[model samples]
Structure formats: structure tokens, C-alpha cells
Target: MEKTDFDTLIERSKNIRTAYHQLELQHHGSKWTIEEDTLAFLTDAGLVGRNTMSQQGRWPKTETDAELKHKLGECVWWLTVIADRMNIDIKDAVEHFLTKTENLLEK
Candidate 1:
């Protein structure tokens, strides 16, 4: 198998979601706005945090390792998708994020 780079991941993720949303548009006659989709992903990110707590025994051991990894992957996937929707490359976003955080940390 060919090694998948970040660019491939971004393309594959975008293609999969485009197909999914096409189906949603066909049957539901609607798709969520970018803000709505971002909020939905934010909710999923929160679930990942909750799962972390559960695994740590802070609440309950409810999340398996695979499940936790899946949610975390989904969070990254959604972030890439949102960045594409906003016309930015995920690589650029990552660079911008690191630069901003480093500058903030130096303050």
C-alpha cells in the first residue's frame, strides 16, 4: 500500500464528505451551513474530551482505545474539511496555528 501523506488525507477526506453531502442534498434538500457543521464538529471534539475523562476513570471507563482514537481522528478530519470550505490548505492552517501559539506563548 502506498503511504498516505497529509495532502492525500485531506483530498480523501474532502471527497468522502462531498459524496456524503451530495446524498444529503439529494434526499434532504439541504445541507448545514459552515458554522453549523463547525459547531457539530465542536460537539464531537467535546465528546472526545469526555471519552478521555472516562478512560482516565474520572467519570467511567466507557471509551475504548479504538473509539477514542476514532473521535480524535474525526476531529482532525472535520478541521481539515472546514479549512477547505474556507479556502485554506490544512498545511497552511497548521503553520499559522503554530506561529500564532508560539507568539502568544512568548508574550
Candidate 2:
């Protein structure tokens, strides 16, 4: 697979959100309410159930590593939507956070 840049990832995330909303409109006769879409995306991404870390004590588990990775991607999609809805630039937000953490650690 090819590596994607930040811009590409953001665009792809937005596209997925748009497609999901379109489907919702078709089936439910309305675009997704903000909360509904966020939760639905998270659930579809398999991040809804009990926390995986909490289940680490159990030797046997059903979900594969690949599934977890996909769920992580879904989380990115959710974050992208939230950022866009709030008119926040996620790239800048992330950079600011990283810089702040780095400065704090250096002190």
C-alpha cells in the first residue's frame, strides 16, 4: 500500500464521512444528526464495545489485530468530522499539541 500524506488522509476521511451521511439520508430520509453519525461511525469501526486494553488479562480474544487497526482508522474519521464541524484545523491542532508537550517535557 502507498503511504498517504496528511492532506490526503484528511480528504479521504472527509469523503468517507460524506458517503456515510449520504447513505443515512437515503435510508432515514435525513442527514445524520451530529451525535448519531459520530456514534455510528465509531460502532462501524468496532470501537464501541468494552475497552480492548481492559480485556488484555483474558488470554483468548476474538478480534484480530487487523480489526483493531481498522477501528483506529474509524477513530481518525470521527476526529476529522469533529474538527471540520467545529471549523478547527486538525493539522494545526496536532502540531500545537505536540509542540506544547515537547516544551513541557524539556522544562
lDDT of 1 by residue, 11-88 (tens): 998997798789879988987678977997999899898888888888667646778899998998899889888898
TM-score of each: 0.84, 0.79
All candidates: CA RMSD (Å): 2.3, 2.9
Candidate 2 versus the native: TM-score? 0.79
Residues 14-106 of candidate 2 have per-residue lDDT tens digits of: 898789789988998988777876677668665534336425544356655566666677777788787886789999999999999999999
In model 1, the Cα lDDT at residue 62 comes to 62
| Number of colliding residue pairs in each model | 0, 0
Candidate 2 residue 68 Cα shift, in angstroms, is: 0.5
